[model samples]
Target chain A: MSTADIAGKARAPWMALDKLGVLIALIAVAGTVLPFAVFRANRIVLGEGLQIPFALEALPALVLGVLIALGIAIALMALSPLVKLVGGFVLLGALMILIGLAATGLIPPGDSFARVSPGAGFWVLVFAFALMVTDALARLRLGPWQRITILALVGAALGSLLWAGTFDDLSILKEYANRAPAFWAEARTHLVLAFGSVAIAIVAGVPLGIVLYRIRPLRAAVLNVLNIVQTIPSIALFGLLIAPLAWVAANVPGASAIGISGIGLAPAMVALFAYSLLPIVSNTLVGLVNVPETANDAARGMGMTDRQRLMGVELPLAFPVVLTGIRIVLVQNIGLATIAALIGGGGFGVFVFQGIGQTAMDLVLLGAVPTVALAFAAAVVLDALVEMASTRERAR
Target chain B: MRAGLLIRLVVFALLVAFLVNPEAFAFVFAPLASNGQPVIYNQGSLLDLTLNHLMIVLIATTLATLVAVGLAILVTRPFGAEFLPLSRSLANVGQTFPPVAVLALAVPMLGFGTAPTLVALFLYGLLPIFENTLTGLTGLRGPVTEAARGMGMTGLQRLTRVELPLALPVILAGVRLSTVISLATATIGSTVAARTLGEVIIAGLLSGNTAFVLQGGLIVGVLAVLIYDGLSAIERTLSRRIGQRARA
Candidate 1:
């Protein structure tokens, strides 16, 4: 066969089957077959819950039109690469809007105590949309910076929507509404725990790292200890800290005055600090050791003292790597800080455990979504900072 | 170093003995009490808890390694090159999302049991192995592969005999990291009703008993250290072998 004939044969089948065809089909099947929401009387009780199944025939005219548009977008995915990409995003956005509309419409404002939350069908649709977006972004072949920019823009748009009370009618938002003050307070406490631990880690870790680097004999022992410390589960570490801290609070004259306690910020901060140290310490040692020997010699030739050389030459060279470690520690601490709640340290984990206890999924999501967002945002921002620092170093 | 290893071995033996018969050490914990009563974490056998913890971690890490290595192999091939970014981001999502959140999200679909914990552990363990496998595979020397090809070896043979052997050290490093991480993370499985060492810690938290917490933490911490050392030794041996092979 000629090359043209072969190309046609190859392209035809792929063209007929879009990249996101399977996800769209899954969403379609789930939306048709499953309940969209469950109606419950009040948040905590699950008795006599009514399932509100999804039916295209039952949807309002506007929602039906949107669904039709989404279907068209899915159909258009097989046409061309550009069309497929745009169609994928359109399908995603349309599906989100449909979910919002359906949620608001199905749950009347008059019935305040009767809660309507998302069901399995809603989750499947969300998953399908996420898959569609991921596939589209991959096909787009955007650079990392460009992709991050798009992500930030989308995030900003979503934040604005949320700020504008767009999703206030949702059950999750209702949960948030009930505990608005506590949510903000817990968020503040979470930030304090994460940043406070990171700060302590830097203070302790950097000096320790320098000492380890300067004293070769100490490196292995120190790293081994830190590695072992790191391998202890966060919960366990928090647990381990409680007795010692409580003892200090009771025995030490001024300890309780400074917020030292068995179950609260003190042990939580200590655990987080311990967890953050390994990354910072290892990255510092690695960064310093990897700095070119020639640079140090040149600094020495320039009549620089050891301290001066370290501050001016070595640290600048190693800054990006050290920052990378800090970035890792920061993101890690954000996630770990959630565990502070389990210890009565008062972060987002409060919502999570409380939700589990009460069997309220919305409460769990309230705690979880923000924690994930914070971690993701921290990573993205720090990655950008590291990139910027490295690029500047390369330029120099 | 020998003495250290010997001490570690003894500690491990003692801990195992204590776990198998925690009541034997009840006197040690008797000094610590909460609510005017001596604290005893006797809800389950510590031996069973430790075993279950190990099993969950092993299963999760094994599945993670398989999937991660498979993805790495796929994306290293010419046809799957386009999926590199997609796969990387997917793995990043696995790490960026906390294990607790994963457990929380999973419990609804999988129900509260080993299944959700396994899913959480598997996801949490993915990124380290994925990144390491990618680095190991992509960092393979083109000259070595070319030499293997020149020897009239097929692509599969070259990969199996040359590439994988050379990449084994790095892959082992990845596995070591994943295993260590999963070991620590598996403790959280108790929250989802999975039998794990975390149960002791959780019970201690609820009952205001520091002794139970210490007991659980000590076992998990020591287990982590031992396993970490074991894996590091294996990695060191593999690297030495690879080094010797390269010199030859």
Candidate 2:
């Protein structure tokens, strides 16, 4: 045999034991041994863990048998790319359905007080399978557009599952049911606080950045001020804003009339806006500075005004970096908005703090999940925009 | 340079003065308080709270640096290269997930206390360290590494003697960022019953005492700035030693 062929044969088994294989093994072991769900006697009480077999007791024996078989197949065999991808989806789907079934099955008839929450095992299994699917997708080396399409598909699937009430039995959903109205209201406030701040930052910061770039001397002083502002903690900034804003609202003419105040949306918005300026202004400066000299010279030769050159040439070329700043601000503002609730600003953090106060983890999840999802969504959308902008510039 | 040194000394003196007797600053905050309200946060000693907060941040940042730098080293190596995507995703994942949300989520699993706060801070801090270390290790000039290889240096020796030293400044920058972020995050940990500076802020917010709010906010803000300044100085020194330009 050829040396290469001999080496390939010798390395076959070890090659099969790749990262995905190790992950799948972890999934199987964790899924089987750890608690799949917790059976809480009621809200506000600690729950008892139910292992996989007990958690899935309500499911048909055949379903459990299939789950075990699937786990073994994915773990023992070197899965084909297509099989791994499909297997991950199937496993996740099966787990979701089975968990719901288990919750429903575990609840005694007419006992509405009891709750069934997904335990550590359930999360671990979900995380592992999700990682496996992600790994499979990476192996396939799909384009950005393809990856985003898959993200949309996965999002839609999850949405449909939620819409279909697949997890209605889950305590998180139960908490959601209790304050559906408040949830939507808080969600709106969260978005407004996050996006409004970013919108303002972009409008003001870009122009300021351009001025800074033009003036040269003002750049360092202005940026140093912003840097100091950025170094301050979000909560502290929010807290500091209260006294001055309260004073302004009380003493300044027409301040209170325009919704300016120590607490609520005004202070939160201002604090977030202040926090946002550094990234936007600095990135805008960086982007404009990096715009090709050739483009600027061409514009000048074409008799374009300074404004025209900046608007038509520099900004467009620099659009991706500017968008990146907005993305950072948006994601950051979303997270910070949760803390805004502490000062009566009204956002998802209202739920978070309330959940903490009440010792209701599901309520905390209600706040946290959406905050994360919003940040993730903002990041993905902005990332896509940045990519499209950069590619367009490259093409030009 | 003299002015900068003077400013640093003043900041250090102020931090020491505040810790030694926070009530001494009560006059500064008194005007912001409503009638008859105490102007200083008195539930916990400001020094104790500040120390505890710093302790939490130190622990979390150290742990995050170790794990994240190790992961970066692993994924950059030939044998562990397949895990690069996973590590990249992890670093990306850290930024998208807010520290507050992570902290809240951790409460459900680990329950209320320092443990959950540590987990949250550690998770949140990982990205900067990992990303910077990866960049530092990989961004070395080809000739530099080639010369090391040509000198009959083993992989471990080359890594220790050449790669890590060159990468130290960048890696330190990452640790600085992580430490500052963990400082902010650890403040939020107070909501989860962790003894942090946020306790004073929360107390102020809860009681609607502007002075108390100012005290907490002032201390945390000053602490963050001092720590940031201290780290920047170290980063600059390291960068200068390595003949690389220091990044602010």
Candidate 3:
């Protein structure tokens, strides 16, 4: 075979795997598992009682801590091809986190983040694997500058954690500042949930956005409902969920126990998902409209079916603009999602609400700092993804 | 164009139907729990309080326009391009920083009064106003600016007689967006005990009186958004007039 042909064949699997979400899954699982397995002690104290092989009840938190650290690690190492220096920095950073956990006896648990405790090692491996595979595919789409930006964001996130702190029930800024690591451990859950929900939002919304755009009546109808949905104040809507859902869960036998809510993550995620739809949907519609009538006509002239025209032409052409909308939605939600803590949806917001209740500013930062960083990172990543994925911008 | 108009008309009709029968509207508009509350019309009505809210929006938008346009002119002066984005970013950061948070911080220093609300409104209104002003002015091609200077115009003369006049259309558009956002945001003023129509909505949300809360929220929300639309129409008309005058 020609060398060009050989290279194409070799790269195809990796490229195909990346598209299938294998890369992010690998990152998430490996990054989550190995770190947790190696650093269980960093999660909790060897509390006063001893019955099992592990003296501390911190293993659940250790898994979560490892997953967040891995998100940082992958976000950092994803830059290795561009910077060469970041890969080493990520390892060193991970090591330092492990050491710091060893120094602090606080395992930081017994809260909502530990809700789905399926054994830290097991969950870590699975999540990291999934996250890694997904990211690998996305990595192919990102360019050098985009990779550099992600690395820089990952660095800033680490720095923010240092700056932000884990006041956990301390209520005082000074105390929270001292216990920054634990505070970050708490903040990690919120960031993960938001990221996870936004991920699902993209999976569902992006294609649906494409579908609705092509069908004029559907677009008009869906967009109108979304507009009205946007008008409802977030807390009020979330509070509204309490009465009906609580009633439904009480009566609806096998249904309530399933979904993400169980009265906790369910409503918080639903509320965030609803709030998220307006921007994503509108932006998609606006961006798709801007896709130039000429292109849509050309796609049709080529004898392409409606589906081909949407996927092969309009959606790709309109992606960057659609991303801008997603960025707005994601950024706004990161801040507003803090309200989720009020309903037992874990994240950095736990501190914001708790602090507000007690009138403690330090506690609020425990939630606020990471939230701001997460929003910033999300904004940057959306830009990178849009830039990398679109061939139209490449011609520039 | 015809389609958009038809769609807006249908939406308006639906809005009327909902307003006339809030109980039915509640199923579609308010969350399920927010039905069956009774309204006390005298204390709860927003129609009577329209002037107060409208003035707040108008005055705040005007102040925002003046500051934003002034800043836009200074930035566009021979040395503008480099500094313009920085100013734009600050305005964005201002808008993005949640008006509620800004109001909270401003309250402690400005005290329990309208002054704090004004400052918060001004800050909140800066983004759209500044962006539109900058977008409208600097985007003027070199020939346009040069022609004004050729007329023996001083820098200030160039700005008022040429740049500002030509840029008015776009700046007003920006003002419309800013004014609407500010009107909605100003409702947070109620938290600090500042007098505005928002007091009803906030009171309703905090108390769980479904009917009272719905009426108060519905009234304030409708008025704020409608006024937003009203100001937009005025902006379009004003922009058209300015453009026509400049052409003349």
Candidate 4:
């Protein structure tokens, strides 16, 4: 065959089906066929599942119609970016609304004992559509500003929906409402533990990194020690600290005054700080080491001291890499901070462990969803910062 | 040098002594326990706990490495290149997602036990292996593969004889990392009723016994460090045998 004929053959519809579309289609089929929500007599007991038809029994037929139409649209429109993006958003919005309505409709009126939760199929549908939208966004290749704007818009939309009590009927939301005050308090504590540990690590680790960079022999030894520390399981590290810290709190003067104890925030913070050190110090060292020697030479030619070179020349150039290390630490610490709840450090993990103890999955989601969101947001923001920092450096 | 060696020997001897007859060292841990509470973790033998812990980590890390490396290999092939972005994002998501959260989420679907913990550990361990294997397989120098192709080796033969051998050390580094991380992560499995070392620690936490916590922490920490060091040594030796510098 001629080249043109071959090219046309290769570009045929069936030959060029979008792979992501296939995945979405498969997930959609599974989602449509499986239960969308579960209806329970109470929060703790296993519940009966409500498939799409039963789930939509409470809502108008139009909701189910929209849901089906959106699924098909998303699957078919995968090759068209704008259509895919809009379809993904619309599908996600429809799913959320349907879930809330389904929960509201499923629950017996004035029956406080009933619980309605989004089921496996609901999650599958959400995941598929979210993936679809994310793929479309990636294809758009938006700049940093546009990406941030989208992130904010998504956040605001979710926040407003949450604030307006759109999902208050959902079991997870009911759990949240029950512990609204505690939830906020734990959210603050989670942020603090995650950010605070990294802050301390940065303050301490940067200098250590700089010192080690200057003194080559110390770098390997210090990093090795830190690496060993990093290898320790976070729980083990936290556990290991309890005895010494408890001893200090009991016997040492002014220790308890500052909240030093065996099982709580002290051990948690110390453990997180220890874990944070290796990433921060190593990345800082790498960044400083990678600073252009020509820049150093120029600084020297200007009669700049070692300290001056670090502050004015080397550190500025190295900031992005150091920030990268900080980013890794932050995302890591946010996750680790959940474990802090086990030690009484008071984070979202409180809900997690408590839920596990009570076999309350909704309560567990109350903790996990936020922790994941926080970590994901931290990763995104820091990633953008890292990008901006490097671009700025390049311009300079 | 002699003094340092002597100090090391003494420490080693003391460790052995503590292991052989731990009750003798009970006095040292006395301050950690409340009245009538045991000064050592007694829920299970320390050795068993350590072995069980290692078993969970081993299973999870091995499965993760197999799946991740397999997926990486598939994506690197021309026919599977379309999947590269999806696989990459999945790996990234796996990394960013925390093990504890995964464990908690899994509990709802899979219910409590070693099974959910295995799923969590498997997901948690995928990213490093996937990324490293991708890097190893794709980052191969062009001429080496070109030569293999020119020698008339089939695609399967070239991959097995040339590509995999060259990439083994790098892939091993990923395995080492995943294994070490899994070592720590399996401890959390105890929270989900998994028969792991974290049971001791959690029990200690619940009972307000610092001794149990200390004992559990010490064992897990030691196991992690030992495994990490052992794997590092193996990775180094493998890299040396292949005439390539170890990345670390």
Candidate 5:
């Protein structure tokens, strides 16, 4: 009914998460119950013609009822502070999330309910996140506040959904949540498979790129390898790895059973990492090469050594661009990480594969939402890092 | 454009090694499978897979070019000066988020198949095409337009005859980029039930077969990159023709 001012520009952090705001927290609690209500509450719901049931039922209710209602209330309130105007849409989105939960009925009172899986709750949040993102991305006629508030809301919606496992099946979450030790086992398994291979890629790719760049004879050779590597399909790449890695593991110490545990994560990470190398390497090469000819000349004129010029002038200037490459790689890695699920690597792919296996739309969200959200979150974080690094360079 | 002699030798060696040696093939295929499980290669039948992948990427790229080129043209009109930043930012969003997310969201509506994959690829391809097209069109000089008008060329004539000829190279580069990315991304179409080379990779992943994955990955990757390079060459050639005429 009423609007409020955001914190001062001097207090940027206070305005960020809005720690004091409860924000559909009640709905989150209700997440454990919305399934029954959704199944029960039908205004003769017309399902979306070409959608999964969860989306089919939930989107219109939220868009038509909540998003529109809020759109109108704010439409009339011209005097609403700029921050609240954006935040109002966010709150409306949060409210619609509550309705979405009820509309989808993620947490059913009984099996008799239309009985979308628990993951429906998460998808509700995902839909809200999409809504918020679309809203944020729409345009900002106002100021930094509008963009910040809208973007923050989109982030918050996505984060909360992931945190709550709203987009996934309850069975897996409950199983994982209750079976903490097994979850840990799985977690360690994934962390190792995912992080380990990616680490290997970073180590190998950077030097390889630099070496290739520096050596005239090797540049084309290495670049061709890079290009070839860039082109290899991850599926094919993974398939290619299986035989040798298996041979090594079986014959070699402690390696044979690595990917044999029902074919999930390990191979996926390997394939993903292989895919990751090109962007990192090429970007680094490009960034390094892009050094102004004059800048290099100046370093030479100043009597700097090659190493000094590289460390002092080139790497620093090129750091931003190289990091931009890394950023792209990292975000790409997150998406590819989902493919690791095909190999049983875990992360968000579990739900996706499960969805495919069970032929249930709800189960798919278990993997899909998190995969999408994780990729997006990674993109945002890397984006922020890129902005910070570039701005710092500019300041310098 | 000729590479140095030693560099050329290395390239030849790598090409020979990859095309000939079983060991070199191993490097390419090792990661595609797991547990010696024949995980990759010949995922479904070959023809269906190839067709699916090609269609998805090709359709997406074509659609993206149409929409992006149209939008770019509109925004380059005289009245569009005030909105350049906004258009640029929208294009950024096309690249900013993960394309996988776009595919996931699209899958539900379009159903799990090539349609969803096509949409994802289209959105993914949109940014590069939009920006390059915009830059190419907007980079036009006032004198060129004045000369066209003095020569009594109509608006459409000016756009199609003069501006398009000049902007073709830059625009084609964008098309090349978007096409290569779409080709790689056609792999994701598998999850949505759109057949492609991804089936081979996913199979290898499931079966733990590296060779199959490698085979598919290598073929697709080489094909995509070479195509990209070839397109780039075509762009260079076009630019040179225009460039030579301009110089004259």
Candidate 6:
């Protein structure tokens, strides 16, 4: 045989071993040897709960099948590339099966008041499997659209499982059972509080930004004031608003009629709006100022009025940057809105504060999961919109 | 500039006076005080509370800076480059999850008080420092690094004597941002039974004592501004030094 053929034959054996796959296997081994789960009663107090030790021998046939699949996957990593891909799929499938079993099967059917929460070891396994899947996908070099599609499909599958009563016995779900009706109301309040403040901030901040940009003297003063406003803690800002708003509600004609009060939604909205102003204003100014001189000249040469040039040229060019500012403000407000519950403003924060007072981890998760999910979703959507806008502009 | 500095100093002095003797500032908050209610937050010593608040912020910010900067350094290295996405997502998770939620979640594992508060603050403070550290390290001048290499400096030497010194200003900006944020957020730790200025504010809200709320807010706000200004000055000084060195 020729030298090339001989080299290819020699290299084939070493190519089978996937280094990251080995790491994943090691983590899985650690996970299997540690405490796999915690057994808790009700949603609140964790009193004298039993720690379920993980045992390979004690696992049912289905779980054992999953563990064996993981082992086989590690072995396949050193084999053919196609086999490596199969191993990845097998690991992902096993993960899903594990989650399903933990959520539904691990706890007995009659233990409605109890929860079988995944412990540190289980979490480590989940993390390792996720990392392995990500590594495999990265190796595949999938396009962004394909990656997102796969992620969405996986998310939908998990969501369906949760919706189909598979995880109804989870402690977090039990907390939801108690507040099922009010949950929708609080979610609505949260959306309103977040979006309403963003709208107000944009309305006031954009014009102020334009004015500041046009007037050199006002820029520093306005920006510095806004900077200081941003530095105030959300809680402190809410506190600061109480007196002035209370005064306005008491003294101003029709203020209380318009819902301007010391506590609850009004002050919360005001604080969020104030907190949102700096980023939007600064971004607006920056975007407007950065519009090319050539663009302005081109608009002027076309016989456009100053206002027309601004509307048609400057604003359009600046739109993406301003959108970025809005994205930051929107995501920020979602997280900040959780603090409003502390002031008796109805939102997820209500659940959070209630959970803390009651010392109920499940209730806290009930509030927290949605809040984080909403923030992440808002950020992703806004980022996608910004990307679309910029790409469209570039295409033009 | 001198006049501005004078104004800041006066403002800081007044803040310290207020913190030292909150009753002295009672008249300023008198209008917000309700009938039959005390005009000042007297249940806790304002000085002690302010110190405790600052201590919590200091500890949290320092820990966050060390961990975030260390992680950023690791991820920027060629060996750790593949973990960048993982580290980034972890930081994003911290940012997306509200500090209140962190406190609530942490309390179960860590129990009530300073430990949970510290955990929440550390997580909340991570993003700014990590982003800044990454930016600072990655944004180092190519020529400067090449010069260091040409002089036969080893990787560690180049990093310590060249890259880090040059990147100090940017990294300090992150530290400043994290510190200011922690200072403000530490107030919320009181809600979880952590000793903080927020305790006064929460108590005020519950009792309709606007004066107490104002007092707590005013102290926290002033402290934040002072810390921000102080850090900005240091950042400016560091940048100026770097500029002078470049010229040399």
| lDDT by residue (tens digit), candidate 6, A107-187 | 667877767655666566666666665555545655545555665776687688678776575667778888898999999
What TM-score does structure 6 among the candidates reach?
A: 0.90
Residue-wise lDDT of candidate 4 within A141-248, one digit each (tens)? 667777787778888988888887778899999998799899999998888888999999999999999999999999877998899899989999999998889888
- lDDT (CA) per prediction: 0.79, 0.85, 0.58, 0.85, 0.60, 0.80
Q: Which consecutive 10 residues in model 6 chain B have the weakest lDDT in total?
A: B239-248
Off by over 4 Å in 5: A1-88, A100-108, A111-113, A116-199, A250-266, A297-303, B1-45, B78-87, B96-107, B110-114, B138-158, B200-215, B244-248
Once superposed on the true structure, which residue ranges of model 1 sit more than 4 Å away at CA?
Answer: A1-91, A132-151, B34-36, B244-248
lDDT of 1 by residue, B1-248 (tens): 89888988898898888877778888887776656654567787788888889999999999999998888988887767756766776666557777788888787668777898899889888889989888888888789888999999997897789888889878888898888778767787777788899999898888888888888888888888889878877887888877843210
RMSD of each: 3.6, 2.1, 15.3, 2.6, 9.7, 4.1
TM-score for chain B considered on its own, for each of the candidates: 0.92, 0.97, 0.75, 0.90, 0.80, 0.94
Write model 4 residue lDDT over B80-183, tens digit each, in one string.
88667766666665567777889988988788989999998998888899998998999999999999999999988988898988998889889988987788
Write the residue-wise lDDT of candidate 5 on A1-396 in tens digits. Answer: 223343343444433332112222333333323331223122123232112234335564445345434433433332223443465556545543444454334444554323333233444443333333343343344333444454577778756875765533333343344445644564455445545665777788777767766876877667667666666655455555555556666676666444442245556666777777887787778878888899899899999998999889988887888777777776666666655655556665555555555544444554555555555555556666677788888897
Give the lDDT ranking, best first: 2, 4, 6, 1, 5, 3
Question: How would you order the candidates by DockQ, starting with the best?
Answer: 2, 4, 6, 1, 5, 3
How well does candidate 6 score on lDDT at residue B2?
A: 100
Q: In terms of lDDT, which candidate is stronger, 3 or 5?
A: 5
User: Model 3, chain A: how large is the TM-score?
Assistant: 0.55
DockQ of each: 0.55, 0.73, 0.06, 0.70, 0.28, 0.57
TM for every model, in the order presented, reads: 0.90, 0.96, 0.60, 0.94, 0.70, 0.90
Q: Sorted on TM-score, highest at the top, how do the candidates line up?
A: 2, 4, 1, 6, 5, 3
- Candidate 6 CAPRI-style tier: medium
Better of 1 and 2 by TM-score: 2
Tell me how many clashing residue pairs each candidate has.
Answer: 0, 0, 38, 0, 54, 2
For residues B74-146, what per-residue lDDT tens digits would candidate 2 score against the true structure?
A: 8888878877776676577669887888898888779888999999999989899999999999999999999
Q: Tens-digit lDDT track for model 2 on A152-174?
A: 88789889989988888888899
Model 4 spans > 4 angstroms off: A1-15, A58-62, A65-73, A76-78, B1-28
| Per-model fnat list | 0.52, 0.65, 0.00, 0.67, 0.38, 0.62
List the candidate 2 regions with Cα displacement exceeding 4 Å: A1-6, A9-15, A58-65, A68-72, A75-82
